[model samples]
Target: MFKVGDHVVYPYHGAGTIQDIEEKDILGEKLNYFVVFFPLNHVTLMLPENRVKTSGLRKIIQPKQIDELATALKPTESSTSKKDAARPYSKENETLLKSGDIMDAAMVISNLTSKEGERTNGLHMEDRKNLDRAKQFIVSELMLVNDLSEEEAYQFITDNSKGA
Candidate 1:
């Protein structure tokens, strides 16, 4: 269980700090919960202690670990064509979102950014929306570990994400 003052990331809610932890009765079930406060959105979330793992809740990544994600942001040489690109793209993004894996989240940013390079017409509305969410998660995490403004985080991702 995460203690108060610890930074954590919730799959559905991005990253935040555990403002407090307390027990509350919900439907007569007295259980523990972590109260998280998101800086970016100014929103507070209360997540159950028991469901932490299933909810994809975990501590923030260190700055050094960002190097790993940076590699994922790099562009690949081969361009494999997709039969029905949007379908797979959407499904993959959804999986990552629900999984709340930081690396996979970074991969989404890299994949979507790189895919934009391949598409002359640019990403569809659906892909663009997903891209926005993916990028926000990355940026949110970066903001916590790296002491960066929102714009700075976005630029950092963009700069490192450009293929070598």
Candidate 2:
């Protein structure tokens, strides 16, 4: 269970602070929940205490792990032909993001992000959505772990993703 004031990555919702833990009656059962508040969106999320693991809630990745992720981002390359099959690749990226492995997530984003002269019309809409999802996951996690603003994180990732 997460204690108050802990920084946590809340999946696609990005990073949030655990403001409080409260017990509420639901269907005659008392349930303990974490009240997480997102500073970016100014929203609150109530997460079931028992479902944290299942829901993919996790602590911020360690600084050493971030270094590993940065190293992984330094060499982002994917065979476009292999990714031609949209659904499978997209699903794979989604899984990578959900895994909460920053390096894998960065690889997925770098794979999907287009360069200055690159073309994207050939890519499927689903693939684009998946790419956005993966980028969001990585950016959000990076922001929280590094204590950076969203814009800073985006710019940093964009700059770092070029040759990765």
Candidate 3:
């Protein structure tokens, strides 16, 4: 269980800190909840304490793992053709996003970035949205793990995604 001030990622919602844990009575039953503040997204959530494990609430990746994440963003050869790479609104990509694992998120971003690079018309509407969401996930964790500003984190991901 995470304590106050712990940095954690809440799946598709991106990363945040555990600001507080409160117990409240509802329907005459008391339950504990975790108050998480997502600075990147300007959002807060009160997740049930009992649901943290099942809810995919996990601590942020360690600083050393950043190198591995950068590697994941690097361009790579793939068996699938560009046109079929990460098909519009792909379920596989969606699952990766929902996994709440930083490496999984990196893989999704890498695949989509490669697809975007291969396209002249750009990603379809759904694909574009997925790319944005995947980027946010990476950006959020990057900011926390590296103590970087939002712009810097974004640029870091963009630069690494380009394999530069």
Candidate 4:
């Protein structure tokens, strides 16, 4: 279980610190919750303590894993095909975004970016939205794990993804 001051990732919300754990009374029930504060989004969330696992909340990637994350961002042959066409509602990408896994986020970034390269008209509005969201997830974790500012984290991802 995460404690106050721990850096953790909440799926689709990026990384945040567990600011506090408190018991709250709602609907005549007293339940424990984690008060998570996401600096990137400037938002705080109250997550039920018991749902951490199912909610995909987990610790940030360690520093040693940074190299692995970089690898995942590198441009690669995308699995996206004409049938999938990198649609905004792609189930595979949606699942990756919700997994709260750094590598998974990287994969979405890679796939979407590559697909964008293959298109002349650019990404659809929703596809562009998904790409931005995936980038934010990576940026959030990088900011926490690498002690980076938001600008630095974004640049890091961009530079790494531009490589092979």
Best by lDDT: 4
Candidate 2 at 70: error in angstroms? 1.6
Q: Over the stretch 1-164, how does candidate 2's per-residue lDDT look in tens digits?
A: 68999988877676778999999999999999999987776789999998998998888787668667766665344445534534336777777777766666777766666421144345566667766676666777677778888898777667776662
Each model's TM-score? 0.90, 0.80, 0.93, 0.91
lDDT of each: 0.81, 0.72, 0.86, 0.88
- TM-score rank, highest first? 3, 4, 1, 2
Q: Which stretches of candidate 4 lie over 4 Å from their true place?
A: 78-89
In model 3, the Cα lDDT at residue 55 comes to: 95
Candidate 1: clashing pairs of residues: none
Give me the runs in candidate 3 sitting further than 4 Å from their true place: 82-86
Backbone clashes, candidate 3: 0
Model 4 scores worst on lDDT over the 10 consecutive residues at: 83-92
Q: Write the per-residue lDDT of candidate 3 for residues 1-164, one digit (tens) a residue.
A: 68999999999999999999999998998999999999997999999898998999999999989899989988666567655754674677889899988888778778878777777878777777777888899899989999999999989888898844
Structure candidate 2, residue pairs in collision: 75-164, 76-164
Off by over 4 Å in 1: 82-88
Any idea what lDDT model 3 has? 0.86
RMSD of 2: 3.0
* lDDT value for model 4: 0.88
